[model samples]
Target chain A: MAIDFKQDILAPVAADFAAMDKFINEGISSKVALVMSVSKHVVEAGGKRMRPIMCLLAAQACGENDLTQTQRLAAVIEMLHTATLVHDDVVDESNLRRGRPTANATWNNQTAVLVGDFLIARSFDLLVDLNNMTLLKEFSTGTCEIAEGEVLQLQAQHQPDTTEETYLSIIHGKTSRLFQLATEGAAILVGKPEYRQALQQYAGHFGNAFQIIDDILDYTSDAETLGKNIGDDLMEGKPTLPLISALSKTSGTDHEIIRKSIATGGLTELDDVIRIVQNSGALDYCRLRAQQETQLAIDALAILPESIARQGLYNLAMLALDRIQ
Target chain B: MAIDFKQDILAPVAADFAAMDKFINEGISSKVALVMSVSKHVVEAGGKRMRPIMCLLAAQACGENDLTQTQRLAAVIEMLHTATLVHDDVVDESNLRRGRPTANATWNNQTAVLVGDFLIARSFDLLVDLNNMTLLKEFSTGTCEIAEGEVLQLQAQHQPDTTEETYLSIIHGKTSRLFQLATEGAAILVGKPEYRQALQQYAGHFGNAFQIIDDILDYTSDAETLGKNIGDDLMEGKPTLPLISALSKTSGTDHEIIRKSIATGGLTELDDVIRIVQNSGALDYCRLRAQQETQLAIDALAILPESIARQGLYNLAMLALDRIQ
Candidate 1:
């Protein structure tokens, strides 16, 4: 049976999720018209809001009943996610996200860039209001690493020499670190110190699995299927896991072609590159890795109390994995 | 007598200034090579270190002799300033700042944007270590307003009907708000709540005076005199104070010309716009406004016990005015 996200995952925390969603709306309110409009556009364009939901689930799983602060934390997580997405669109020069025109596309880069900055600052502003020093420190440090991760990805662009270890580091920073913050932050907020490690572990592995799947889809899926063009990463010469693994498993002309594609980003050789990635067993290895990561994520949740919320987090991870299957 | 910045303003807090300068250098150190290089390049290209020096002087004026935390706060001010400058360069698509190549020019827009983000996160990370909720709230709120101000400026761009009140709001967000944070933050950190209002008032007015004079010089000063090109504001179609005032004080073809110049940014009618602004007495009115703001700034320092540090703040305001004289 397939996992139904609304029924199995979000059901237990549906009320909290709604409240958290409202907080996000109220939190991004600004006096500037453009800032407000662009923020609303991007936030509404946001897909699933998985991170904030994970935060809400993690809080409930910890057996903490009081949730006034938890809701705000959830909103902060989503705002930070939205802020990065806005900047990412500018960095990628992308015109669409989730089939909607991106902030950069609808408005100019100047407006997107400045409004993105506003969102980031506003996220921090809301986090400060939660009045938890531990949470603040974690977020501050986590956000710095997130930026570093983004820069590292840029530094690695087109370099075929980037190893899996380096790839893990990048994904951990860019994607998983925020996941860690969301779950671990919730645990800290709920006064459940013992659950911090378990939740961090769960979020870290789950985030790694999620990004690996995204990278795989980048090579395998097209605009009609995923709302993201196939070969988008290759177009940027990003040595994502698929290409990295493909480079290791093949040699001769095929390896050289993959390397050239990575070094010089564009789509002229995209068909050949995709064929090579598929034939070279790179996608298989990526699938195995994603599965292993998903299992570890679910296993970590065992440390949390056996509540509907923990099961919700578990179901959410499995549902993410079901995407590729 | 002309005020010497080194002798009159910096001398009182010279030792603290040097220490604060070192802190800025230490603060920007990052493991990522690109982040480190871009941050160092921008910091080395920094002009006068005026904001951080103001931070030091403000701390001293509050009768707080222990200089440890104050130096860090000073560094934070400079870091925040550099972050905005980095993003500003990207938004403006400029190659130079203070006669040096900007981060975007030296690297790329993508690199500049990401590094700017890293600097902002690092600043907040360091701020969290200080463990002061009130100070954190002030900065968090101040940064949000600062971003809104920048967006407001963008919104006002190429807009001819921008009001003086709106322009003040813009400058308050873009320029003076940070100055308020630099000084007012010092008061908050030093356990001097009594000094907060007066220091905030001084910095706010001083920043207003500073920006008005800069705008005045755009019409009145040449590249050789101020290292800023005449009619550069017109080139960007920035509805700054001179053009806004000119709009208020003119009509007929002159008023229409100013309005058109603002509505469509470029240097096509640079000379005519300059002449009209000068002949219409817009620059004179701007100068008078600058002087009034400067006087109000100096008057705010009367609440502080007269110390050389207070005098340094006063002299800093005077030196800014000296540029026009």
Candidate 2:
């Protein structure tokens, strides 16, 4: 069954999700015109806003009816996400994101970097206004881990020896950590400590599944798969799951080809690398792993009482798997 | 007699300043090797540790005998300073800072940007541990202004018509705001609200004077001046006070030369701009402004009772002026 993101996931918190945009606009508002314009460009360029939507859904699932504070929290989540994406575009030297010209491409790297910084500081400023000590601590610590995860991924680049454990840690930091913060933070803000662990677990596994699906798409060349550029990961020598799995399954020439591609980080052998990755059943292993993570994510929700919001959260994880399917 | 920084300023906070390094080392300690190394490189390359020293002196002047928390605060100030410098190098695209290879040059822009982010996040994580809401709010707000200031400077670049008022605004954000946070944050941490305004005023004015002197030195080449390369600002079309003042003082070819130099941002007319700026009484006006700001900074310290720490703060501002003298 095809899951409609609007009907299945975002529907539960559509009103609050829309309300979150005001706080986002307010958050990015600055006295400096350049800061405002560059920030507005990047924040608007944000894709789907999955993290904040998850936050809104998690707040609803926590049995909290008043979502005024949660809406602000969702805005902070989106701002932080936007900030990272802005820097990511600078780091990747990427010109286009979601079919829109990136901040780095449109303005310049210098403007993009400073405006990204403004968004981060502004996010923290808004987060402080919530005045919740526990929430602040969680976010502060979570941000550090998120940055470390990004650096870890950079460190792992071109290193074919990067183990699966290392890969998991990287994804956990870069992808899962923020997701954990989004849901767990809502639970924290709403004074629902009881739900913190369960929501964090659900979001963590779900984030892993989401990223794995993303990594799978980088190699999956379906003409219908909108933005997924085939062999993008291989071209960067990013030893994502497919390459990591292929490393273990192949031997001799196949292994050497994979190793050289990762180390050199180019597209000269993209076809052979993709063929070996497919032939070695690495993609199958990756799909199985994604399925397991999605199931674990869904299982984590058993602790929460049945609600439309919980079902929405479950649907988000399932929708991620649908990408792979 | 030339002021000895060690005896005149650092002498008061020497032991505490040395102890602060322990906290700095701990703050940069990350599980990720790349984050740790990049952070360590930048933090270690820090010059004179002026900001943290000012913070310790401010804490002492606030009559806080217990230096434990203050030391950690000083470390946070340094980390924040280091993070900004790392990003600044990336923005400026300069290969060297204080004659040391920048993080962007040492690793890559990607590593520098992400690790700079780690330093920022880690600084906030340490700050949240202080459990002082007032201090957190001050820092969160101050960092936003700093980023805005940086963007404002970028906006002002190649703009020959940048007014002195706009120049002050740029310097305040790029330089003084953090200085305000450092001293003001110390006061906030130590429960010295009464001293907060005075310290903030002192640091803010001191930051202005310090940056003005730096801008003056950008055009002042005595050959013995270590890192102050003449016309560096003009080369980048950075309309510092000298150029802003020159615009007010000159006419005809000299005026057009300055305007064109700023508008174009290169070294072709560098000699003409420098000759006009030096001959046009613009540097004189900038020197007067720096002196006025230094006096204001020192006067702000009058609210604090006479103490060696206060004297140290005074001397730090004085030493900044000694460069111009």
Candidate 3:
């Protein structure tokens, strides 16, 4: 299914992403070649390119067929997304990302930080060139929301009793805001308000599901597949939804182990923690919640006319959930 | 003179700065009150509020009659400046800033970084509200330039033979860009096209003078007056202009002492290093060069009609140089 989605929907958008790479590389100054080199390294180290692809696909799906603006918007979203990741790696102090050393790890923290700032500045430059105030305002607001979400997450770190409402808000800020904006921005460019709203709803739900799956995979997937160490979220002391949900449900021995693991933020007794979570049915619980989100995302797309892009988006949502388990 | 500038130009701007503080504080969600509180603590710690005050004063001097816009621009620039400092403290691993514990020191690195991100986002939010495209573009470009400067400085750290050109470029990025933008942005806002170019020129010269003085003060000033420990830059292996110039002139025994001292980057024998710098005439050379730049800044203001604000700016430039020695 992943291969099919990649072939049918993401292939054309991949070309757009390539064009973006060209644009950014061209923008690099000779004096700051180190910044450009490090930025390119992190950017070219492959992610799914899901956000840009969604943007391109959503624009196409809306039946406004000018590929140039869509492609630029796609690149802009991806660049913004990459900038956030660079900053996130610093904030998380993560040594690796996507099976490679992070920019911060390879180059010092200062380089990583400044390059992140450069990328953000470059993104805004590209955004202004797009010449759409409404789109610019939306994207800028989305960027702020993402930052706020990150701050909220930082504040919530290591606190075991973080409520579900807080968790949802954080995820919305950190994950869903950008995802929704990507689609919504594309729709705005395409000049379809109704479709833009529908795409935003679709992307928001999909993003929530995507984050849930990401948290679940943190526990279930090994380092090789996930491109990061298993239980990294635990080690980082991020009180993700699954653990919090399980803590609320279980008590006594189960609750104590989960609580201590989160507080200490290590895998000292990995098997024991895994056993507690498995026994508590936390994984299943998370998967059920993700599935529900995926369904809602699919429902959001029902308002749009049936098309390959819509189907591709639906498949992507399902893939987000299925990839975890 | 410094005290008077602080009282007149800076004090009024301080009131506006207070309003800006209130604006940002109100924007933060109650959910992350702790993070906001910590962020506010770091921001409110007594620093001269130099950048924002420059923005306000420059705007007023450019014949911008509206105090409110000038104040808003001042607050925005300062917020951006504060954001950079917060991130910089983390990158530099410094424990103190403005005679208080740094955000990174008080909290962890993650909180410092995220809060920096939050502040930057808030700055953008403020910029968007200002609805000035040219100002936004210049400010965004300034951010990129500043980050580039930081990266340049980071690359130059601990490199014994760092060139004068590289040193100048580094300072231009690290300090001059903000000053250039603050003053130039003010001029731009006031619709003073003729003075705008000169204001930027003045800012450029003044910023160079300001940073050179800062470097000189790192050697000459006590901790109380400087709000940072003398030799802090040396301990951090920052190859500032005075040291570079001193290195260029000296050879044999004195050169070796300077080299070894810089290589070690601590004040085990700080007094001895200070003696070598003083004896080498490096301090005098830097002081002379800074004074020249201040003169150039004053000359740049020749086109502007004389007013209290212009006199204040000229006095501020001279005061910056005087404060160093």
Question: On a 0 to 1 TM-score scale, where does candidate 2 land against the true structure?
Answer: 0.98
Docking class of 2: high
Give Cα distance to truth, residue A167, candidate 1, Å: 1.4
Cα deviation of B113 in candidate 3 (Å)? 0.8
| RMSD to the hidden true structure, all candidates | 1.0, 1.2, 2.3
Residue A75 lDDT in model 3? Answer: 77
lDDT of candidates 1 onward, in order = 0.92, 0.91, 0.80
Q: Best by DockQ, which number?
A: 2
Position A46, candidate 1: lDDT: 86
Determine which window of 10 residues in candidate 1 chain B has minimal summed lDDT.
Answer: B224-233
Clashing pairs in 3: none
Task: Encode model 1's per-residue lDDT on A1-325: one tens digit a residue.
Answer: 9999899988988888888878899878998888899999999998888999899999999998767789999999999999998998899899989899999899988888899999999999999999999999999999999999999899899898999998998899889999999999999998998999999999999999999999999987779978989899999999999999999999999999999999999999999999999999999999999999999999999988799899999998898888788
Task: Tell me the tens digit of each residue's lDDT in model 2 across B1-325.
Answer: 7779999899988999999989999999999988888998999899999999999999999998788899999999999999999999999887878778999999999998899888889899999999999999999999999999999999999998899889999999999999999899899999999999999999999999999999988888643464535777877889999999999999988999989999999889877777898999999999999999999999999999899999999999999999899
Better of 1 and 3 by TM-score: 1
Local error of candidate 3 at B25, Å? 4.0
**lDDT per residue as tens, model 1, B122-151:** 999989999999999999999999999999
When candidate 1 is compared with the true two-chain complex, its DockQ is: 0.88
